[model samples]
Target: MAQNILINDLPLEIFIKILKEVDGVSLGKCRRVCKKWRDGIDGSDQIWHEVCRKEFKHSSEIAKRKAGNICRWYHIYKNLKMWIDITTFDKKVREFYKFSLHDKSHALDVDYGVLPLKDAKGVVFYDMSNLKYIPVAISETNCCKVTNNDHVSVILTKTGLYVQKCVDSNGVTEGFFKAENFVLSGEVIYFHNGTRAGELLLYRLSSQKKGPMSRPIFDTLAILPEGKFAVQLDVCERKNGPLIIASTFFEIILVEYDFFPHEQEPKCSFPVNKLTMYKRLLRLKDRLQSS
Candidate 1:
């Protein structure tokens, strides 16, 4: 049997078409074949944009058909975030953007391109091949809190609490968080610069006020530690309380406040980076980008 092995012989446009059929990983391999291939692929960002849309759109459909309600929707949305999350803000997010979600009956098999909605609020995922931004019904909200520390800005209407530099149009904070609850296996310290009388303040991210503020979720036994360090502990929390892991650094140390008659202080320590913390950050950024 004879197999054609002359791929590079094809025209540049044909080579691009070939590149389009492959994926990011495989494409990485393809680029390694020769300098020509590397230059050709590097010249185009359009391919990355196209493949990503298809992957996410299909994944979204798979999530919806999996059978679940809003919780399920959130579950799927979050699970598939790695393939669809875009952090670069449009600055003009208040503008409406065109989008279409899953509609099994009249499903759009667009293979061309999509246009960005002029007045888009949330992140716009325009299918460059079909001129449509696949839609996902999102509940959004935003609110601000004034404080002497860092000029706290928060927005939590219904979707979730966002604490960041500014408020999202949906009233969510543009700032990113680990989640409602997180656990700690390593040492963690709390900075007292903002705490009043050493009382850790807690803000319930919701549109409606349930009660009061300044409620402590859990006290920092050693207070907030400065610089970077590591510790160990066995920390856990329920879905309602995920042991917020947004530590001063990446690790959280639940210092043994009280020792059980038989229990000892936690020996588990949070991982510490000796150099080039950029690796830790870039890994996170990549995950967020894919989401």
Candidate 2:
């Protein structure tokens, strides 16, 4: 006859090793088993880190950086898990609204509980919280696309790109060049300049103070191959830095902006200047065939 061993009797090292192999949900259940188990799980940051690594492989580092040094690993894990659940889970439609407008409305951009929609008159901000349309006066009637963040709204028209403060609509800053298409990620705008050379430009919304009279300026990032113009653009912040995904008629380009290296250096040291911030990671031609 042999005596049976209880799970609680296991050594701390062996216990943590076993818990590490379990999924996040299972780990949560184990933490509720008893005081000893909860303390054991919560005390080890490695367990939470491992959970985050397995759950959010692509965004773990980015989340950790945003959380800062004082934030605990468990809190970071919970926040990321919540965001994943909110974004990925499917839910039935609760309600819908029909709006009468002149001409077909352009693509709308939503951020921070506000959605900006472009109609015949101008760009109207639909407040998600209050359920009201606050029209922002835009002179350009032929608006192509509209996007915004918490700070400012960017309107792309056939003639030029316009940036206006979200609070004060009176001060509108117009770009010097015409853009075929553009994407707004936070304070940065990545756009395709409507030119034969297929030039991609970057405009920083936060750098308005650096320009004359506090106006934003454009920086030429990269130039695509001749005859290949970018029709669509997307930007996302990754562990490394900001990544731009641009799709042309024939090819898809992945460009990464390296801002971390320069950011890490001391402010007193001379800035490490580069020719261009755009670093092409991968270019796939005939994406449909390649897939």
Listed per model in order, the count of residue pairs whose N, CA or C atoms clash below 3 Å is: 52, 0
lDDT of 2 by residue, 23-126 (tens): 88899898899899999999998898888889877566555533223235675566555442332333222112223442333324333333444444544444
Model 2 shows how many backbone clashes? 0
Question: Which ranges in model 1 have alpha carbons more than 4 Å from their true place?
Answer: 1-6, 58-291
- TM-score per candidate, in order? 0.23, 0.35
Mind giving the per-residue lDDT tens digits that candidate 1 earns over 1-291? 997868778887887877778865676687799898888876765554444445556645433332112112322333344222212211111112212432111111111111111111322223221123334211221111111111232222222233333221235323544333222111221221222321222322332344576443432223334553322211221111111111222332222211111222233422122011223223322333344
The best candidate in terms of TM-score: 2
Which has the greatest lDDT?
2
